[model samples]
Target: MATEPAPISFARGAPSLDIIDTEGLRAAADRAFTTDPAGTFAYGTSVGYKPLRAWIAERHGVSENQVLVTNGSMQADAFLFETLVSAGDTVVVERPSYDRTLLSLKGRQADLRALELEEDGVNVRAFADLLAGGTDVRLAHLIPNFQNPAGYSLSGDKRRALVALAREYDVTIFEDDPYVELRFSGESQPTMLSLSTSGEVVYASSFSKTVCPGIRVGYLVGDEDLIAKIAKLATGTYISPNMVAQSIVNEFVRGGSFETSIATVKTALAERAARLADGLRAQIPDARFVDPEGGYFLWVEFPEGTDGDALFDAAAARGLAIVKGSDFLLDGAKNSIRIAYSGVTPDEIDEGVTRLAQAYASL
Candidate 1:
């Protein structure tokens, strides 16, 4: 029998499974059960495990009342969609956004607007124009830190201005920041919630990237009243988010494994990113992409006239996986691609980029 070539994947923004502390999580689960079996398995509060809630609250300088835990950040996103946005209400998002976010907004029947994303972040001038144009925008959804598929953080000035614009337009800025803690370089900027002088920001993050992905624990931080409303929705929807997972996450964080895991993951991702960048530079010099300071994705702009979909198909056909830039579009982002180094090994990144460069040249 002929051997199949291994698929070199640059398709998904997944943490490398090799470095995940599987044994640590297993031990944490055992500890949770040994300590409180009944509590571990019981139906719990919708707002999350109190200890976990307190931990997050204290870390972020917010009260436990400001936090509402969910199954994952995706669930938080859904709850916000259901609670805040009415049908036919306008929502603005980055031009090339996380595809799932666009899908979520569309599922809620939101009229979507796209703001052009620059290297520094969303075009503030354009967003200001939208606010002034009399469009009744209900939400401004953004992945401000190392935005997925774009790999750029908003400038500090723009972050403040964006919050100001949201207040002026009476729009809630939903900041999805799953990868904020993953930065390998650069100083952190103030979060949207922190910049909101007018109380118009909703913040969300998840442990899926930092911890094991199976631990479906994420939380939304916002106004206490809004969190209470969402907690009610969660209670009605699923009774509660996963108590068992929340307990396990609590143990993991309390044990101080979270920081250790983050350091390990960052080291690996940083190395992988460097290798990927070097490989691309050596093989395809014409390709352009902002070298991310930290994050899973590297946004690559291919040579002019390159067909993104065609390149996507070509790469897949050759036992490699890559995302077409068009897949991340509400409007369009042709002639580019998103390569994820977080999921693949450094060798896989090199191999994938080599194959991708070949595919590009062959076209």
Candidate 2:
């Protein structure tokens, strides 16, 4: 009997556990033990820990009342749809976006209007047309920084234009920004939250990427009044979020370990991204891709005639897991593939690509 090699996954947008700060987490546990363990374990504010909220508010330059803690950023995303979207309501999204978000929106019965993604971000002209077509758009959800699956960031000009368009069309922009802090290189862009004068944008981010995945602490920031609406929804749902995790994150942020952890992951991911990009170029000369500035993805286009699904299956059979790009789109991308590089090491990336190249060759 032949045993398959353990698969090297290039699927999930997972940060490497290799560099995660276990010591900082241990320190947080210690603080929790001393500072009232029972209270830490008990139900706390649905708005999240005051200190954590305060820290996030200060970091993003919003008011504390404008921030609500969530089980994770995805839960915040769910609440956003619940608060704003009704059945058959129109929601705008990037053509190839984070699949989970698309699924969530579909679950909400949202009429998803997808804009074609460009290297700089969404196709602004197409976006304008979508707006001009007179759909009663309830939300325009996006990943403006180091976008998931696509790995493209919105330009400042486009960001301003999109926000203005949202304002013109009376659409709220839901900015899912889990990857903004992971930039290994390049200057930062202005957030949609910073651009909105009318509070048309709701910003969500998680510590799962930078700090630790299991911490499960993330937040939603908007105007105090809007945040109050979200918080009300939170109370009805789970009574409140996990206070112990909140305490741990609050302790971590206060102690200044979060940024250090971020830098560590960024360094490793940057190296892996470069390695994958180079390896693909060497091993599969026809593979088309853009090397990402940050985040876990590198979007690849196979030879025109190749079937991405077949390639994925072949790769899996060869013990290398990669996502078919069509999974991220509403229509389909039969020849497109998305490879996540941050979760695995440089060596694993090399081995994964070797298998991937072999799979592509066999196909």
Candidate 3:
């Protein structure tokens, strides 16, 4: 009997264990305990650890009053959604967005209008048209840099246009950018929050992408009034975010381990992304995808009329796991899939893409 091949997963969008800085984290934890034992152990205010909050504000060029630390970016997202959205409210999102965002908005019973996500970013023209046509849009959520499923960065022109639209339409732009620091190449565009003078952008980001995900530290930066409202809601929900983890993260940054870790992760991800792209092009001539500049996910589309479910099942059978594009959209994208290369090695990426090719052939 022949042994089965080892499973190669391109599913989880997390750093591989080999890339995680365990030793550095341990040191940070020790420093955190020694430097701020009381703050780390106590149930502090809902604003999160003060030091981390201050650091985040300073880094983002915002006042400390505009920041709210949360358990993760997801919690920050939830707070923002609850504060901004009510049933029947209209929210605009990218067609192929992060699935969890769609699920959360759907749970709120908000009317979600998904725009076609292009190579540079969301269709600003379409969005402006929607606004002009009198669709009272409450919020526009975007993944700005290295977007979650598509791995496309919003171009500079699109970014400014989006901010301008938000200002003119009086709609909020939720710039959810956790992978901003993970860019493998090119200069990053200015965040919508930075571009907006009318307080039209609410920015959310997470340390989970650059640091280890287990830390569970994320934050939101926005208008002072808006952040205060969210913070009160956060108080009712969690009393306080995890202070121990925030303190550790603070120490990690203060000690310079954070930058080192980001560099290492970026180098690894760049190699893995390149390998996955090359492998797909070589092994599966029919596979079509835009190369990502710096993020974890790569979106691939097969010929039209292909069944996504059948492709998913086939990939599983071949020990290659991927996310179907249908999960991110309200409907359609039956020929698309998202491959997460962040959690896999370059060698694993090569093998996984080959297995994916086999699965596509089987389909």
Candidate 4:
């Protein structure tokens, strides 16, 4: 058998943290060892490190009591699901959504309902109709800003309406907003959590995008009582997130380098996104895609009769890798694919798109 070549991947979503300030980490570690060596090494509260919690709260314009740090946003979702979802319970999610979220709910045996996504956001009218038609929705998981696999942001009006619908239906809304700060274009939009009136939104975000994914720090902001319950669940799970990582992030934030770091990452991501988009448009004119205002992905739809899975295989055969859109959907859509531009450089973007064009040609 002929040996296969290593695949060039456009499937990663996290930032390339090679350029992050290593000196900051050293300083933070020095502070941790000098001031509270015992605390740094010992297990701490599950609610997350105090200073990190305070920093997150201040950033989001919430109180520390409203925040609960988890191992990552994925853990935060699991904790919330464990606390809120029962077997046979119904939850609404975008049609093409995060695969991990779908897996998490499926593992818990929740009835997953799909809502179609429009260019401006989730179809609010369809969602409202579902609620009106008596969909027993217990919760709705939404990615309001630069949605995964779709690369579309919910408009402010739609966001407010979605929040209102959740309030009217008396259902909790999980605003999974890990990509809100990664915007490379367009004006900022209001978060679903900010528009929600009934405190029905559980807002989650992470440092995995703007900072190093290895830090594994993410947080949930919601009703204090609900947050407290999730914190308890987290306490039982990992006891708490890594205290050393939390302290490093907290010190970075306090030293006023957090904003600078974010700016640096955003600049690089914007350049990469532009490179990917332009390369795709030039190389594959038949491919249709929405230019994402933020986030690392561009969601592309091939011409009808195109098989994304076949394209995936073809691309992989040519030493390139891309994710088929069906993987992100509860009910598979066979025509689309998600291309992530965060990890690859401009040359890689060009080469990857060129390979993808060849794949499409083969199909």
Candidate 5:
């Protein structure tokens, strides 16, 4: 008899659709149809829908002129790179950062220099030294809160220091803060934009992590002049993001459901994070992980000499798939793996961690 495999998944970063608010979509549709159906369907200005921009500014404490809504933060990054990065231009990034950021910059033929990431944040002295030595660096991108694979938040002091370094070096800082609002525990840190009054920080965030990923709504906030430049590029590229989707998000946030939805998702993610951490501790005693205060990932570092690729294969064989840390690094970090707990239920976390333990033991 052929037996079916166990159904356990931890691979994706998307939110479960079951919790998404379709009713908000209906309301948005109604408003669009009733108020200005033709306008909704027509080509929008590349600067994005005006009301959505205003909403974003209000939500993030920036002016509407500073906000340029894009298809998603991924697109936001693309636009920024396209506008700012010349071929062979040097950029600073955190090692083991988001893979997509690496791919985007590489696509532009930009030279990416990675700074070693510490648990608290990127090492300040090393970062300062790079700038102080004048390393032809054009831009520095950082995910300050609940960073992707590392799942570490930058302390307030470090955040300020990094910004100061950027100012000292006359380099632009791309503060990629997609996971800032996902905090399940701990205090929220001040954003680089909040700290910098000179418009040196270009901030990007998304609704994919908090709301439905399908909404495909994210935005960038920066100097009005820089944002206008991005808007020109956006006009040539995407024309404009889905107006209907923007309206949906606007309606959701305005109706107060967005806040409620955030609270709901946070509660579930907190439980899953706790469950996974507990299971990892019990099942793989040798595995070391920093339990994230927020966001969807638990970064587990296996003992030195453990083969991350082999462990990945073994876990996949047991119907549990996870991303090895080496995949996140530009220079290859082979002893860690990023386990995302956001997409799975609490029970699934337990099962996945148990299978991961078995795979680690076998290795």
Candidate 6:
């Protein structure tokens, strides 16, 4: 009997345990319990832990009324979708967006308009053209910074242009940017929420990437009324979010360990991204990809005729696990793939790319 070798996964978009600040989290948890055991353990308001919500509000320069903390960003996203997206409502999304996002929208039966994602981000010109065509789009979801699956950041010009289009079309923009803080290089851009004077942009972010995944703290910032509506929905869904986790996060942030944790992950991800890019180029010369400045993912496109399904199987057989590109799109991308470089070490990246190259050769 043949036993499969240990798999090197490029499928998970999570920080590896080595990069998680467990010690800091432990200390924060201790502090949270000691400082406010009653509040941390008790059932709280749907608006979430008060101090943490206030912190998030202050950080984003929004009032507490405009912020709604949730179990995670996904919950916040769901609440927004439920509040805004009726069945068959027209919604915009990036073509190769996070698979989970695509699935969620599909589950809601949304009429999704997917725009092609480029190195600089979603094609705003195309989006503008769509808006001009008079499709009453209800929502435009954007992963503006270090976009999931694509690993491309939206350009400043495009961000402004998109905001303008959203304002013109009277559409709400959902800025689902969980990876905003993970940038290891490049200057940060102004958030679309910050750019929109019309209050058309709703921003969502998570601490899962910067802190640790299990912390499960995430929030949404937007129009006060919209946030209030979502908070009501959240109350119906779950009594309130995990106060224990939020309390710990609040402690972690106040104690300044959160920034330290981010610095560590950023440095690690930078090296890992570089190694993956270099290894892919060296090992699989035919593989086409944009070297990402930051974030967990790198999108790769093989020559047009390559069968993505076959390549996926081949990679699995070679002890490498990768996500098929078709998973992210509504139609075809049979030769494309998404590689998450965040979960593996540099040595693992070298080995994984070599195996991936072999898989490609076999195909």
Give one digit per residue, the lDDT tens place, for model 4 in 21-134. 666667766876677766667788999888789888887788899999877789889899999999999999997998899999999999998999888989889889989999
lDDT of 3 by residue, 1-363 (tens): 178789888888888898889999999999999989999999999999999999999999999999999999999999999999999999999989999999999999999999999999999899989999999999999999989899998999999999988898899999999999999888878888899897899999999987789999999999999999999999999899999999999999889998999999999889998998999999998889998899898999899998999999998988888999899889977999999999998888888988888888887
Better model by lDDT: candidate 1 vs candidate 3: 3
In order, candidate lDDTs are 0.88, 0.88, 0.92, 0.85, 0.86, 0.92
Top-down lDDT ranking: 6, 3, 2, 1, 5, 4
Give the TM-score of each candidate.
0.97, 0.97, 0.99, 0.95, 0.96, 0.98
RMSD score of candidate 4 (Å)? 1.9
lDDT minimum window of 10 residues, candidate 4: 16-25
Model 3, residue 82: what's the lDDT? 97
Give per-residue lDDT, candidate 6, residue 22.
92
**Residue pairs with clashing backbones, model 5:** none
RMSD of each: 1.4, 1.3, 0.9, 1.9, 1.5, 1.0
lDDT of each residue in 1-363, candidate 1, tens digit only: 278669888987888789798877887888888887777799888998877899999888887999998899999999989999888999999988999999988888899999889999999899898889888888899898989988899889999898888887788999999999889988899898888875699999999988977788999999889999999999999997898999899888888788988998888888988999899889999899888888899999986788888888878877889988888887555899999888998878888988898888777
lDDT of 5 at 246: 76
For model 3, give the 10-residue run with minimal summed lDDT. Answer: 1-10
User: In model 5, what is the error at residue 224, expressed in angstroms?
Assistant: 1.3
TM-score (C-alpha, index-matched) for candidate 4: 0.95
Compared with the true structure, what per-residue lDDT tens digits does model 6 show for residues 36-130? Answer: 99989999889999999999999888899999989989888889999999999999999888888899999999999999998998999899999
TM-score of 3: 0.99
lDDT of 2 by residue, 38-61 (tens): 658877868987777888999999
